[model samples]
Target: RKDIAVIPYEPRYQSAFKALNEEWITAHWEMEEPDHKALDHPQEYILDKGGHIFIALYRDEPVGVCALCKKDDPEHEYELAKLAVSPGVQGKGIGVLLCRTVISKAKELGCKKIFLESNTLLRPAIRLYRKLGFKEIPKSHPAYERVDIQMELVID
Candidate 1:
């Protein structure tokens, strides 16, 4: 775990972000427009909109990624999304590191809550979210067709 480094978005690793996310998404669920918009141009959809993306590097190679997407709401919430880890490095604590980094970043942004939309098909991911203190919440109007469950973590 000490060898893994979680860093902010960099132009050089843009492809790695898309590739890492697409790996899991395409394998389990079909890619939606929201995925394309975020993965194709992270700067336009995330960074410029006051959101943040974190990438996990293992031995100087990209292995995981997570994004905290700002919501245009009065509550000042962010959607913790696009969490993915390389197939080869699955269950190696990379996802937890990326998520913790995003949670910290959300707090730094003064966010009131962090929510996420996911599908029931990914049981492991759901468990991870729960372990991170995310509780199941009523599903909102999801942006992607794949979302079946919603969870939220109130930032204190």
Candidate 2:
């Protein structure tokens, strides 16, 4: 992880976010409408809506990305969406770095909890979420057809 750096989303990194996510999502499931909404217009869908995205740079090149999409939950929660690490560098701890960045940003934004929708087929990602202290939660009505399990992490 020496060369890894987690930085806030910028317009310049938008393509990286979209491409990285598309790569992973397409590998397992077809791109859904929700995916295009965020990936295509991150500025409007995420940043302008008071959400945040983070990109992991390996030696200054974007290799992974994650987002905390603002949600309507009255409990002040955010949806942790669109996490992806380039396959070439999988298992290098970049995902953990990106997630930690999201958790920190949620605290900074005074969020009560962070949640995500993911499919059970993604064993590695599910494991990572558990390792990051996200516990299994009742699956919500997901926006994507692929989500089978939902998890959440309560923030202090």
Candidate 3:
């Protein structure tokens, strides 16, 4: 097993962050826009909103990332977003490790539930969510317009 460490996002990870977004769009979203610019926009907003971004490093190399957005509602919930793993390092269980870490962090934050939006094109990721105990939920968010699936997990 690789030595995996989760750290908050820092300026140093800009390149790795861009790479992950580019790979995800090229492989799954089929978007032609520059992922770095598109991703950086939201990254800025999330950081400003008390959101937590975690980067997973394996052997000192950035391999994956996940984020938890603090909820605005009084429900004491959160939203998990921007989950990405280096294409070269995928299937090595890094994604799962990142996800488990995010979930644990959310629970520690006293979140009652967590939600996420994902595209149906990503079959493996959808499966991973199910395996992690996330269940399908109604697509009510305006952001769901670009997403094909929405899921939620109740944190105990």
State each model's CA lDDT, in order. Answer: 0.90, 0.90, 0.78
Give stretches of model 1 more than 4 Å off: none
Q: Please give, for residues 64-104, the per-residue lDDT of candidate 1 as tens digits.
A: 99999988866537989999999898988999898999999
List, in order, the clash count of every candidate structure: 0, 0, 0
Using lDDT as the measure, name the better of candidate 2 and candidate 3: 2
Give the winner by TM-score: 2 or 3: 2
Model 3, span 1-156: residue lDDT tens: 448788888878867776786678666555433334336654566667777778889899998988787768664468887789987778888888888888998888888789888887899999999999999987765353458788999987
TM-scores of all candidate predictions against the true structure: 0.96, 0.96, 0.85
Order by lDDT, highest first: 2, 1, 3
lDDT of 3 at 138: 79
